[model samples]
Target: MDHRFVGIPELTAVPRVAVVVDVMRAFTVAAWAFSRGAERIVLAPTVEEALALKEGRPGWLALKDGAPAAGFDAVNSPGLIRSRDFAGRTLVQKTTAGTVGALAVADAPLVLCASFVVAGPTARYLRAGAAGPVTFVVTGEDGRADEDLACAQYIGAHVSGGRVDPAPYVHRARNSRAAADLGAGRRAGCHPDDVELCLEVDRFPFAMVARREDSLTVLRPVTAPVNPAR
Candidate 1:
């Protein structure tokens, strides 16, 4: 299967084996929540909808949209998910890029939520399913290329096999002086620990899958079947 690069919104037509990456924050937060014992997480496309979801499920924690600006509950920060006392409660997350990306790919044949932290497991999840073109649905900054796309590239190269190169993103990420300039503009969102969490490789073997019910997207964990190749 030939691998192709597409914008986040184009993930809808991707074949059954597609990986979703929100490395900068979203998936990292989801993984953190799972680690924190959150029963489940509802991926809402927008903050308003997420809030509405909380109304129906009183115990779910809320996270607003993150884009040009951080929304109400902050940009789905891992700090928030980890810091909160979410023993048995669920989290309702709405991110401008991640959630929108999830919505766009709602019809993918097999969608697995992923990030660098669980890149190895995500790859295992894809390979175990079947041989099909895998699209890394990376959520970008309001249609603009950002870290998420690079994270997707890394995971894609990891799972898809063949000669892989990382010089592209390593150079870009290292030289990205935008942090100096955008610091004033970049919203106070993801926590410092979150940055570390998002960068980890093979931190876990869980694959988060989205299940559409009525309108909201419910995230559920899918354990990789024991595979020595993984």
Candidate 2:
């Protein structure tokens, strides 16, 4: 399969397997939520929908909207997700980039949601599928640069069967105007720690896979249920 990294602007050219990356918060938070026992995640295109879902799901929790540059769930920090109890719950998430990007690319045949946390499993899932071009889309702050681009580089390296090198983007990512937006969340208030968490590749063993529905797409973790016997 042909795979390459492209910015959101060039997304139309390669629309088959569009892997949306929002490592710093959106996608990273999604991964963390799932890992914490969130039964399912509904990717809401708008904060309204996210809040609605939270209200509808009874036990469902949400990550609300942040500032102009920042995104939903400034409270949905990695630390919050990592430390909180979601033993039998689910999350309805919305964001400026990650969820929006996934919503925008809902028309694509195979749209995969990814981040550094699930990068390895995401790669394995792609490699195990049919041979087709995969486009790595970075959903940055205001859908621009740094975190998303860095994530794109990370995923791009794996997709191309090369070693991951995020240094180039990391240095540049630190200087991005959107960097602060990404750091607005709780875990991110301490930027360095958040960055380190965001850069930890292959931390998860499953990938969040999405398929188009009537007008929306459904995203859920791709993993075989644990066998109670094994």
Candidate 3:
């Protein structure tokens, strides 16, 4: 298998597997929600699309700017969603980077949304299914987040059967300007608690696989038929 890492801005080919990396918050929240029992995650290209989705479902939660959209049950914040009971609810997600990145590569055969929380399992899953080209799309806040690319590199390295310490990259993320802004002064966009969850590497044992369902791309964890190659 040939694995390569590139920022979302540079992605071109439609590989066998396209892993969308958004460790900042979107996918971190996703991992938390799935871990806590959310049935599936539906990615919306924009707030408009997400709103349209809510119109059809009428009860699914909507998230905007990391907070629950008006009248929704929960927000996109992992810290917030982890406390809510989402046993069978399908979450509608719209975010700055994660979902956008996923939609950007809709041509790929296999699209997997991942964060640091599921990095190891994601790597394992990709390794098990390796048959050809695999590309890691680092969706970093409009191609400016180092942490996102760092995570992509981390996963890519692991996929190639290489070892790299994750602590330094995680440390860099903690002290990043974005982290500082979100932790010290922001309450609406992100907070310390949110960053904390995003940095929990390998917290989940499954990877979120995105499957296109008509107009929606749904993400669900595949946990059966373990086939770890290494």
Candidate 4:
């Protein structure tokens, strides 16, 4: 099986296993949310769909801007999840890069969202009998952000029977434009604590595996991580 790290721009045919990396905040928040007891996360491709899902649902939904909506429990903030309890709750998330990329490659047989938070588990999952080619999709802020690319490589190395020290890669992401976006103070959603939380590699031992549910993808944390693929 071929394991490759690639930017979204160069995508051609989808792989048998496609891992979407959005370390900036989307999947990072997802890892923390699952750890915080979130039952399941519904991936919404558009802001309108996310809000619509939350109309009569039990869980909350965040806007594409990652802001706290009126009826939502909290925004897509890893730091926020650190302080709240979303136990048994469901969350509808619509992000610019992460969700967009995940939906873009919905044709792939097995799709999972990963970030530094669940990087280790993701590697383990892919390494465990996931046949055919594996494509690591880096969901950059717009094009190719350094953080997501580094994360894609970090996971790719492990799936390819190699190891990578995350320290240097994390350091590089800390100085990337995506990291800078969090520290900019221009966006209300980005916080210092959130930035720190997003960079904590291997913080969670599970991966949010996405299944093709009807027209959209629904994500749930597979504790075994590898079992989801097998």
Candidate 5:
């Protein structure tokens, strides 16, 4: 199994197994929502599409980042997501990087939505015998999203049969310019606490797998043993 890392611009080269990562609160919020019992999440590339998906759907909730949209249930903040009850409901999520990246590679045979929150479990799921040439899609713009790149490498190291400490990656992400901007209130509609939440390594014990469902890229959590017998 070979692992390749690529940024959003290089998404066209995505392989059979694509791990789309968004660490600065996109996939991290997704992990929290799943942990809170969300049935499934429908990823939309645009905010308009997310709201449209939630429109007239009784059990659907819409969420996005940067300025509240008309029909969104909440911003893409993990703090707000943690406080809400999403049990058995479907979430329609749109983000600048995460959702767009996932949708771009939705045609891949196996697409996993990734963040530090689900990093360990995601790696284990791949190591458990999923077909590869795995590609880690860094949703953060090419060369600028340090947090997403770190997460991709973190998961890559694990999938490569190496015992890599997650502390450095977490530290790198915490100090990333994106995190700095959010913490300093430079980025609106994003919470400062979200940076810490997004950097919580192995916070969830499941990997989020995305599947193409009609026009939506639906993600569902798949749990795997933390330390499977080798």
Candidate 6:
């Protein structure tokens, strides 16, 4: 399968499979939430919509980043997500980049939400099931999210039938401006531990896949073996 990397603006050209990457904390948070037993996550393109989904709904929670929404349970930080008990809960997530990117490619045949935490499993899933071209959507401003781009490269190298050390990519992500902002606590509702949490490669053993469920784009975890002798 041919692997192509594109940014948010190029999403309209996406082919069969589209992987939306947001390592700076959006998809990472989803990874953690799924690992923690979240039943399903609804992707919201806007903070207002996410808040609307949570209204009067039992077992539903809203999570977002940037200026706080009125009823959001928490921010999109993996550090905070790690300790929460999300068992049987449905999360409505609205992020500055990641969720928007995923929703943008909702028309694609297959959509996968990705971060370093689930990169290995995602790559394996693609190798086994993807029959057409795969596109990695880097969900950052101006198509220049260093950490997200690094994660796309890491996963792409694996899917290309070769394995490259993830060290360099991890290093590049750690020193990125986004990492610096989170490390210095400049971003609202973000924790200092989030930088490390987002950079932890292969932390979870499942790939987060998105599917259209009625009017919502829902994400759930799919566990694929590290190496399948197919």
Top-TM-score structure, candidate number? 6
User: Each candidate's TM vs. the true structure?
Assistant: 0.80, 0.78, 0.90, 0.90, 0.95, 0.96
Tell me the tens digit of each residue's lDDT in model 4 across 1-230.
57777667767887788999999788998888788788788888777778888886644654345666665556666776676677888888888788888887888888889999898888887777467788888888544789998888888876665467888889988998877878775556666787888899888888778888786588898864443432
Please give the ranking of all candidate structures by TM-score, highest first, separated by commas.
6, 5, 3, 4, 1, 2
lDDT of 2 by residue, 110-167 (tens): 8888877787677667766635787777777445677677666666665556355656
Write one digit per residue (lDDT tens) for candidate 3, span 87-112. 88788888888888898887678888
Between candidates 2 and 5, name the one with more favorable lDDT: 5
Q: Model 1, which residues run further than 4 Å from truth?
A: 9-14, 65-75, 142-146, 162-185, 226-230
Cα RMSD (Å) per model? 3.7, 5.4, 2.1, 2.7, 1.5, 1.3
Off by over 4 Å in 3: 66-68, 162-164, 224-227
Tens-digit lDDT string for candidate 6 (28-102):
999999888899999998877888889968779999986555799878888877989999999999988999899
- Can you give the lDDT of residue 101 in candidate 4? 82
Window of ten residues with lowest summed lDDT in model 3: 64-73
| Candidate 1 C-alpha RMSD relative to the actual structure | 3.7
Error of 4 at 30 (Å): 0.4
- How many Å off is the CA of 160 in candidate 4? 1.9
Model 1 lDDT, full chain set: 0.64
Model 3: colliding residue pairs: none
Q: Which segments of model 4 are wrong by more than 4 Å?
A: 58-64, 225-230
Order of candidates by lDDT, top first?
A: 6, 5, 4, 3, 2, 1
For residues 72-130, could you state the per-residue lDDT of candidate 5 as single tens digits? 88788886678788899999998888988888888889999999999999889888857
**Taking the tens digit of each residue's C-alpha lDDT, what string does model 1 give over 1-230?**
44555667565454666566776667877877787688888887766777777777666677763432422344566655666666787788877667677767777767777766666666666667746777666566543455666666766776668334655754443333322223343645544465555556667768788777676677877786556253
Candidate 6 shows a clash count of 0
